[model samples]
Target: MKKLIINADDFGYSAGVNYGIIEAHKEGVLTSTTMMANMPGFEQALNLHEQYPDLGIGIHLALTTGKPVLSNLKTIIDVDGNFRNQAYYKGSFIIDEQEIYDEWKAQIEKILATGIKPTHVDTHHHANLFGDFNAIYLKLADEYHLPVRNNFTNTDSNRRTTDGFIYTMETVIQSSETLEKVFEEYNSVELMCHPAFIDKFLLNHSSYTYPRTEELELLTHPRIKTLFSNHKTIELTTFESI
Candidate 1:
């Protein structure tokens, strides 16, 4: 069977984001989402989770967009103390691997403390796959026994992951014929998405702003829901099942 895990990233980024994700799961093909433990809408996301217990939640380990869950990070943060943006990681910035490990561990523990069993793990801006960060990402997954979203960089036979990972935003807005080709291509795939209602917080913080609303519309569209239900070979699944 061809399995597809449509996972909305940044579940706890803001109220708009939280609501968008919930709507996607409730009315569309979205089967799972990864929550940002340190994001502003974290508490709201937790409360929403209480109402929708079937939506599989995972830790969206972050280091680029928000403040660190653990304080006094020596390398990951900038002079102003907020975590540095994605550009810093792309450049020759030096970071302490141990700090990344400790901070991410705290993020996982924080979500666990809320009594939400995460289905798997992934990173914001794919930061965890950078240099030594991938090792720490895998380390935490092994310790917690959680499957990870495959970036094709951190492959291990023992680690649980979908056979393929698709990050293209264009595919999401394409026709149903295009989407069907995706399911036919991979035995199991993890499609990364960020669907939101486009609030002030999201508008101010994220560079990828308006596209979120576009994604939300496409995700919850009646046509997309029908595609999932009509396709016998395609199975909408969660990371927990992988």
Candidate 2:
């Protein structure tokens, strides 16, 4: 049978986003979410985990766009501690993968130590696919025996662009096909997404935030319900449940 996993990303970016995700779980088809270990409202996510015991939570594995959990070196992060404003940057031929991996492990350890078992793992901004970082993520998933959303999605011709960020965004936009294909190709697969409202605040803070809201709209659409009507989908069996 075809299975579906409706995952919401950015569980701990802000209280507003956290509230939106929880409400989505209650009122929509959100079965899973990824938490940002280094975000401001992460504590709020932890509190929500305590209250909503059935919500399947996993690490978002953030290495871009937010503050870093580690303070050792400014390789993966800027001098201000926030991740470099861009995705996948290299400084003078140095990709900083080692620092990134070290911080990634630390973040994972911190999440596990929270007493909240992670149901699966995925990256915050698709940083897991950068250089050798993908192998590091896969190794961690294998070590924990947890699944991860490998976004091996195909890109349409219209998605091809000279701009890196826009091209990547379009790749993700065209990912439902990739997600479904992978679900059939592998057992117990995972897919990641960001869902939010296109409010003025989100619009002002981030350009991709609106696209994330668009994802939310699609995930909660009635057409998706019909598409999955013939299949049996699970709620991801949260770590909290076990």
Q: How close is every model to the real structure, measured as TM-score? A: 0.95, 0.73
lDDT of 2 by residue, 80-163 (tens): 877875443443335567777788788888788899788778786677766557777776777776656645342432321111
| True lDDT of residue 233, candidate 1 | 75
Error of 2 at 219 (Å): 3.5
Off by over 4 Å in 2: 87-93, 152-191, 198-201, 221-242
- Model 2: per-residue Cα lDDT at residue 233: 46
Across 15-126, the per-residue lDDT of candidate 1 in tens digits comes to 9999999998888778899999999999999999999998889999999988989996989988887888888877687778889999999999999999998999999999
Q: What is the lDDT of candidate 1?
A: 0.87
